[model samples]
Target: MTDKSETAQPSGLPYAMSAYLIWGFVPVYFKLLSHVSPVAVVAQRVLWSIPLLLVIMAFRKQLGEYAAIFRHKAHLRNLLASATLVAINWLIYIWAVSTDHILAASLGYYLNPLVNVLLGRLFLGERLRPLQMVAVAVAAIGVAILIGDALDTLWVSISLALSFGLYGLIRKITPVGSVPGLATETTLLAPLALGAVLYFAQVGGGGFGDDVTTSGLLILAGAVTAIPLLMFATAARRMSYTSLGFVQYTAPSIAFLLGVFVYGEPLSTTKLACFILIWASIAIFCADAIKSYRASKA
Candidate 1:
């Protein structure tokens, strides 16, 4: 059985912050690889992550745990589904960053926590507090505004939110450790990733060996992919979901700053309006969470 007490510890805050900070800065990394195809980048990310994860598993002496997980058909299926979702998320994010749609990608992540709350209510029979409901409704309004004003790129945000939300939901219910589970997901994806790399290489389009700098960056994707996830898993184990949800905003917030200040994505009036509503919704959500947490403590 999962230990509920583990989620309430304050010590996990640093891990959570570290994970979000890394995630927030990820667009910069992807931007450096903008010359490469999104599919190729994602393939490289998946392929490279496997060895790094394996090494971590060996160091942690969890290789046996990983082997044992495969024995369960259900766990394998869940991981396969999660692998698909995460792959889609990665591809979309890479494409968005590469195509100068970082703002849209950032909006997607901003919407993800609300999506998670909605998912919890729908699938887990969790009750949403009144503030939570209001937060969701406000976020919905923001999304609607985006749809009305910038329908062309709205799908990017929506797809990213849905894919990642579903991925988290699956992983939440799956009875596997985060590292092992990620290893399994990458393992399932490795064949397709390898094929993609080979195809790109054959076509003289692979970024892997085209230059020393690009090759190194592509390899670094492995650490970039693995480290934050491990930290997130650790944080999830050590902190309440409410606190984690609050911290999750740090990533999108940084991405938003990067999108506006660094990448120079336009902040048109409509987009600005949408962001305002979303931020308000997040504020409301956080306030409610804090209130409830305090009440529980008292």
Candidate 2:
């Protein structure tokens, strides 16, 4: 596993883009399993991801490194916290997409980078640039607009943003390798996930073993969950955080399009206005990041 602090050059661009692109399209994948209860779907995802992650760890010959993490109690505790956060994030996202709240899901991810910046300023003592601060303010206004419009689903967006933002922060501070860390998280969640699955099965609500297609899709959730994250971890280690942050928009943008076109979600004037504000804020934030990157290089 590479050190998180080690920075590679521009070579990670493709990896980062691929990861976000997959993430952007993931709504379609989840939609296929919309017949299942969102909670059960999440449980399946958690349960399935463990073996897939273990395989990756074994193939990479990083299994030893992963086992070593258990020896450190602090790392386990931090991972436990991160795992809980990610589970919440995942549950909300799955529920959003499954219930035709794709737009809210899209907005949540769109707001996530700004939330990340805010978390950095508040918790890490990192000072935000003027443009970045403006970006945060602008995003807040967009969110406020949604709230003002009585879009009760705004909680979905805010919760997703905050949970994922905090999860990233935890991952940043933890010295564990991404694959191993995620594997550990999944391992911790596995018991609960299994219990959920078993309970659902007992109640005849389990999607597994009902049909081949649903079963396969549920199983494939593991790959879908792990692969993009692994790609993201790779890109994060190899690229500057600014560049990664900029690329993060790809996923949400794709989701936005999917909501509008594919899912036929209604886009009211208020939603459009909010999206415009968010886009403008992102442009400003990216411009500042690019300027800073160039200055640092010089």
Candidate 3:
């Protein structure tokens, strides 16, 4: 079971396919949980997810990773902050999907790359190339085109994207592995989640069982959240960044299709134009990434 063969790339097809397909289908799951409040849903997701993640980590004897993390004050602080950012990101996404704002959610993810670019320049002190700057500018225009009176949801999308992008940046700099990092982050927030669940129950929110069906859907959110992350971690370790980044878009594309066709969300001419512009930005971004990657190899 040890993957020590240098010549053998781990079978990336399973990891990539599972992550993409599962992420693509996320809107359906959130739609099913529409009856539940977004806060409640997120609480349940985080609280319920901890046991599953912990059990897996325990079985793999990775409790030591958790111990190691707590010992490092710098890593611990960053993990807590990153955890909060991810929680906000998750809550906003669920709210958007539940309220039939799937296109907006898709737009957030589409803009995520540009947000990452900005963060790289601002925090990491990395410089962007001219084309990279143009790509980000085009993406901003695309986002503006999509913003038509849905100011609240649009802000939510932008905030979530930027927050998660920065969270990712911090996570990369933190001296922790994916599993341990996620576990610690989720662990830190588990108490708040548990408290919310209890408070909601007392307020007749039905907590975990407001409706049996909704409850089931909420539990399923854990698997939904965990699976893609696992796959992404696997894919990141096994494949090139270029390949992984390209595949990452599949989720949002699937979401766009689900939003426009299946969910019957409006794809106005303006929104369509926005989508096109964003896609063009992605094309430019990818070109730069590929060039950079190749240059490094050379």
TM-score of each: 0.94, 0.94, 0.86
Ranking by TM-score: 1, 2, 3
Lowest lDDT block of 10, candidate 2: 1-10
Off by over 4 Å in 3: 1-20, 147-150, 233-246, 290-298
TM value for model 2: 0.94
Candidate topping lDDT = 1
What lDDT does model 1 reach?
0.87
Question: Each prediction's Cα lDDT score?
Answer: 0.87, 0.85, 0.76
Q: How does model 3 score by TM-score?
A: 0.86
How many clashes does each candidate structure show, in the order listed? 1, 0, 0
Q: Better model by TM-score, 1 or 3? A: 1
Residue 298 miss distance in model 2 (angstroms): 3.0
* Candidate 2, 1-298: lDDT as tens digits: 3433234343678878999999999999999988898889889988889999888788877788789888889898998999999899999999999999999999998998898787777876768899898888998888889987747889999999899888877777777777998888888899999999999999976799999999999999999988887677667656545456678899999999999999999998898989999999999999999888899999
Poorest stretch of ten by lDDT in candidate 3: 1-10
| Candidate 1 residue lDDT tens string, 36-58 | 98889999999889999999889
Give a tens-digit lDDT track for model 3, residues 1-298.
Answer: 1123312666565677788788778889888777777888888888767777788778767778777888888888998998898899888888889889899888887877677678767876768888889889998888887577456667866876787677767665665655667778878998998888888888855337766777777787777776676565555456543345456677788999999899999877877888899999999988887888799899
> How much lDDT does candidate 3 score?
0.76
